[model samples]
Target: MKMVIVDKANEGKKLFRYIRTLAPSMKNGEIFMSIRKGKIKINNRIEDQGYILKNGDVVKIFFPDEIIKKYTDNDRNKYRSIDSNIDVIFEDKDIIVVNKPAGILVHPDRREFKKNLVESVKAYLYKKNEFKPGDYFTPSPCHRLDTNTSGLIIFAKTHFALQKISTLFRERNGDKLYLALVFGKISSSILISSSIDASENKENKVAVKEAHIHNFIPEKSKFIEENPTLSATYVRPLKYDSRLSLVEINLWTGKKHQIRASLAAALHPLIGERKYYTSQSLSLSQMLNVSNYYLHCYKLKINGYEEFKAPIPKKFSQILSEMFKIDAAKL
Candidate 1:
């Protein structure tokens, strides 16, 4: 039998949700069945899956230790050598905001074995004695940025903070601003309200339909009806040259590849973007010998929270100066 005590980090989480995090190897059906069969109990009482966990509650799972250990999070052991040099923008008791450089994955996948942002954050917190190994709830990012997109990403230090921040993001109760250098010149501000089809995604790239003048309309087409998502991007041209435009993007919908695909649909693909760009933009990117995309999440503000901004990366700033003759610091 394995037992877990509800802590502040896991407080307010549903029983089923808490179980999935504790025993990750167990399938959903198995968890439901185990709960139904009285194999799981909270405070020595059988509770439904939807029961909200509270601090000091004791959860018991009548499963073998070996089975529970086999599927639990073992990332701490996997990453012995931790990189603690994280660029922290703002940190408080509840949350930490860091600037993620381009070329690092936020979360590790099967193909990624090296240290990622999560590991780095954990290592940093561990060094400060704020986090401990074998803790059921580890600090995690509230949202994700693309691997090549450099900028501010927030991590929740507590479970209560995670729940609150996640709700803010889900309800779009905050503003996220991105800065980019797109290929074509944008004369004025443009609002691109388009629907993205993930079902049609190929090679890790999603398809964005033509922008509509009105608000997003649900996908009625049979081909992409299964996984269509609404997206809106407000592009304000900050500065422009003959070939490229420095633009500030106000993202209304945080869908996958929303900024890249939406700009491509508007004929103003971001410089250095590998996917969702015209052939001419690709040629220009090749000529410039760019290593990563030029999109950066520059600013973020949650409702009733202090606004946070990440300074532009040195390379990103240098590139802008060399290409457009505009100093990024001034903007």
Candidate 2:
């Protein structure tokens, strides 16, 4: 909703400081720049952009819905129902593992996710397994990948597995292994740490800077307010094919997009990563056509037992055989 502020409400505070009380999500510096950028208006008049608010002064805070709106209603409910084609990987009494293809969402962002993995999994299990209508099938992905990313995913079939798995991640007992193809050759083991920023463009969000914390021009790097996440990764390079390499990465933390962001920050961006460029990498966008991301959860071990892996995805499978010349079918 557009905001109209009461006069004298802020007691003659600076324009940006006053606005912070109204829109707390915006940083003071950001609000100040928005005021300078002519984004803030006063009583429908573009007053001296620097005008401070006095008692009885009306302040119009312009929060463009475009900035507020990241997802649309029609788009939100698009993937509510899980498709029946989800590959059932492995199942025990406590959990179910499914092969999630890239591009399918793990859950509905709103009611309208076009292809929700959880809902689809629910519908499939109910219809095929004689699960009673509204039977309590708790839908929770033990871990997640980017919606555009595909591969093995685990769902807690029972609450016990969910709690155990969740705690496992918290205690760092369970870890995920991702198989990825990237544009450059990374020879030795390296630890990559990056402070990611969700910068926006006209179309979508862009993640920039590889710093421990992202600081833009003029903004000093603010110490990350959130707890500094601990991360460790073990990289095993299987084969190098001049332009790309087939590698397996074991993640030490479950941070959001850790592999993609960390690798990009290290100049070995994922082959198909369209963001966070290091200026020395190749663009895999043109070559990537698979539904999910080029990254795959190729292997998983909880409490140190590795049994589930759905062979390499097709796009990379062919690339693997042709580039490394290993018949993936034989693996």
- Candidate 2 has a TM-score of 0.63
lDDT of 1 by residue, 1-331 (tens): 9887898778788999888666544679999999988899999899899999999999999988876676554544443467879999999988999999988899967674865898799889877878755456678899979888999999998887888898898776877899998997776877787778776534888877767542333332331244246577778888887888989998776788888988888888888888888998998888989756888999999986889998998998999888778777776
lDDT tens digits by residue: candidate 2, 194-256: 545546567454353543422121111222123254333456677785666777887765666
The count of backbone overlaps in candidate 1 is 0
Clashing pairs in 1: none
Candidate 1 residue spans exceeding 4 A from truth: 7-57, 61-80, 213-229
lDDT value for candidate 1? 0.81
Among these predictions, the greatest lDDT belongs to 1
> How close is every model to the real structure, measured as TM-score?
0.81, 0.63
